[model samples]
Target chain A: MSNEHTAGPHSVGRRLIDLVPHIVLIVGVLIFAFPIYVTLIGSTWDAATIGRGSLPMTPGGEAWTNYSQAWSESHGERASYTPVRLMLMNSLIMALSIAVGKIAISILSAYAVAFFRFPLRMVFFWMIFITLMLPVEVRIIPTYKVVADLGMIDSYAGLAIPLIASATATLLFRQFFLTIPDELVEAAKIDGAGPLRFFFDILLPLSKTNIAALFVILFIYGWNQYLWPLLVTNSADMETIVIGITKMIGTGEAANDWNLIMATTVMAMLPPVAVVVFMQRWFIKGLVDSEK
Target chain B: MQRRVIFDNKLLPYLLLAPQVAVTLIFFIWPASQAVWQSVHIQDAFGLRSEFVWFENFTAILSDPNYVGTLRITAVFSLSVAVLSMAVALLLAALADAKIKGAAVYKTLLIWPYALAPAVAAVLWMFIFNPEIGSLGRLLNAMGYNWDYRLNGDQALTMVILAASWKQVSYNFIFFLAGLQAIPRSVLEAANIDGAGPVRRFWTITFPLLSPTTFFLLVVDMVYAFCETFGTIHALTHGGPGKATETLIFRVYQDGVVNNDLGASSAQSVLLMVILIVLTTIQFRFVERKVHYS
Candidate 1:
């Protein structure tokens, strides 16, 4: 690949042609970044500046005021005043719990299916695999009813538990486990290790990269959940930042604080975006591998 | 695909499987069955009385004009998003695959939007397109476009579609880029040595090879538009200008949660499940075919 580019004498026309990709990519990047740029600038201004039409492209003097207010106070005039701080905390907890819970349960289930000969193993595998077809939105009402019946609504368990069962994670782990050599199991047995001990010392250590990659994907998924959290949490204290930001917009633009909402939107995007950017290699691997 | 040497304990496997199986039954399998059951029953609004009316809810939903409209809207919305996002991502991916400088930096910048929540994506676009305060919205109004998505159905649908597609591009970009990268340079170089131009070579060589990835992404993008874009629609338009942007999933939510029309909602849920099942089957079949080819 590198030799092809270096083998030829560089012509002026060829040099110009080589520049096309860079120019196109820059334009693409700018267009993609435009919305976030606008929102960031808007978050720094007072509501009056934003509301008066023609939002300034430059940052204003109200950054501290807007962020502080959005962080501590209610946003919409008519809506419930769920502080962004609490909502961020709720979102954090929900994302972490869902990521960790899904990984833990899925690894166990995958280990069982891959390493053990048990009754109804295929049935259990099929049962878990079939869930890839049933998204939360499709079964919203009945799922809501189940949670309500269990008296789990408005709680963290309600927020995360129903969502923690993941077909993708299970399948990923199962696929990974199958690729492990049989010699490891024999070695563990020769060392007088029990099933749990082998799993802890051998399998768990081997699965670290897969687990981290899956964590990045699941964390974003859990954080971005809107409808499930919307249905289950009736109280303001339990509101996720994603749902909270929308509620801040409310029904009308006139009664809302645009700057505060913008600040919250920026804050809402920060963690997940940071995770993807920082853990990009794992995120990409998990996304591509999970689909396969 | 089991291990050669394995754990023989029956109780340990079940115990290990207990948590996942329990959650799947309680949350997934049970609610799914309930959706099926509720679909066949007509319940009064108050949860007071109910009657088993098999196939009646399905018949009514199928006959309802609003449901039909929603079905059309969903098809249009899903296809538009899939095509638009995939096209843009493919173009960008092709360019990024061109051995250009700063490709890694450009990729990092582009793929970060995959992490943005759909609802947050909606908020960002809504801020830009908000009629009174939004910069672009104000510009449109200034140009006598009368661009208020709040009052205009077409404008609302367009806005919702753009926002949804925007959020989805990074995801498609990552997959497309990977797909493009996966293609062997030897194939393209062979075509190049044959005096075939870049465009002809791309169409004849690159596209056919990329079809499996394209097909996979098509299903994924469609599924995304169908169900996952609920937050985008809910936040941006709330399926309004009088149900203009109401996709099938939003209608289910509207009927079930917002309106408390349980019977209709459950019927819709059942139908949606069937649609998703069909989509999943198609995806799996294609995946299996691809695996065999490889």
Candidate 2:
């Protein structure tokens, strides 16, 4: 432990030595960025050209053709039902519903855990935590069976209802609520504010950073949902964007055109990436907080 | 406080918890239990009906060569992805902590890959590995190595691992970076004063301190790599070229969904759940002790 406290350094040499690792990390970043670049570049090339891997640095003049072809086949497989548009709409609805329901419910649950003295508080918290350990894949089939039995398969509710309680979200809000200054809640109570009023006006407003982070994280989690949606939706009508992309790639039945797949992949990747890029620190912070 | 007593009573708590509890129990717990019940029995090849063959499905799965291979591949895949992703993430996180100019931009670029859904990421990677038109294959062909991803099981597995690792690295990096930032500057300066080299500082000081974060990420990423690589398996390889990429989750999917052998699928799922629980419990037991919050 004492050895870890070294502060002596030759400034320039130290900086230069440190620069070596940073430079290497930049190379790592490039490796990380390669797929994004390849997908974007592939999207611009025609299926024929991109398939041949003959794309030039600049466009060889086939962007419009591929884009239009992609759009046409993609507009709808059935009656104005392109995988792209339909799945995009599905994604928005599913993601929003999950986010809204999850955040709202988790907030309430977290409040109970944080503020109220319920019987077996630790046990309840641990129960929620243990549920987080339950793998989604393990239950996906039985869940499918349940949904099928209920006649909810291929419906929006099928996708949204099953995942209504996000254990991770509840955990996050619970963690956040734990940190709120107790004095404020007391002050609200003294001012004759009801618990609900204090929760809304006093507690929530003070937890903006946490709520913002939670919103972004939950939204991304919802938007990126694939397995449940894939298992739930069969008709082209019910597919989410990610699931649509999955089906559009046409698993063993039809051979896929790599260029078109890449193009669609690029289009599908942008929205979540946009969200992540904007709120990166908060997202990372959220992960760190949860890790604790 | 008396006004709060009514609000805080049993009724309100249950109401607040009702929606989530009901959904989880119905969708997750019920289905999982159903699968467990089904697995003990046997089903027809086409899953039309089940014969009550006690422990037969479990016996068959245990004895099956394919099941063993799936478990091995899954273990290797999950371990490699978790360890490699954590290493890469920590390295990048350390660099970003060096306070280089444009550190924010660098961090943004590094973590962007994680935001892509697994299906999309797998697809994007497939383009790079595509023998016909993928950029990597093209670049490699231009450079003169054969580099066929679909040509062999090893190559195919490698491609999936890389893709999985790529998605995970950003997620690991986010935690690693945050952990790094949380380490106070004063301590790091003190380490420098004691003339510790960077590597020494990292291993002896920084890493031990990041143990809690590392432990947490270890469990999270392991669970993710084990259970959630199904989409990656589906879109990219489809467990093809003789089922090299058939992870436990994907295998369970094939048995339960496409094959519709509800009994056999359920058995596989139960086994998978058992494996997850055991591994997770062991991990928490071993790692939790070493994790120092302060």
Each model's DockQ?
0.85, 0.51
Per-residue lDDT of model 2, residues B1-294, tens digit only: 112332355666666676767777787777777877787776577767867888988888889999999989888888888898898888888888787788877878788877778777787787677776666676787789777666578887988888888888988888788778888899989998898987899899999888877887887788888876778878888886698887888888897788876766778888878877887786667555644434
Per-model TM-score of chain B: 0.97, 0.89
lDDT of 2 by residue, A181-243 (tens): 666667766788876787788767776777777777777788888788888887877778787
After the best TM-score superposition of candidate 2, give how far the Cα of residue A60 lies from its true spot, in angstroms.
Answer: 4.3
Kindly report which residue stretches of model 2 are placed more than 4 angstroms away from their true locations once superposed: A1-19, A68-83, A118-127, A181-183, A251-259, B1-7, B43-54, B141-144, B279-292
Query: Per-residue lDDT tens digits of candidate 1, residues B59-95?
Result: 9999999999999999999999999999999889888
Best by lDDT: 1
Docking class of 1: high
The lDDT of model 2 is 0.75
Error of 1 at A9 (Å): 6.2
- In model 2, chain B matches the true chain B with a TM-score of 0.89
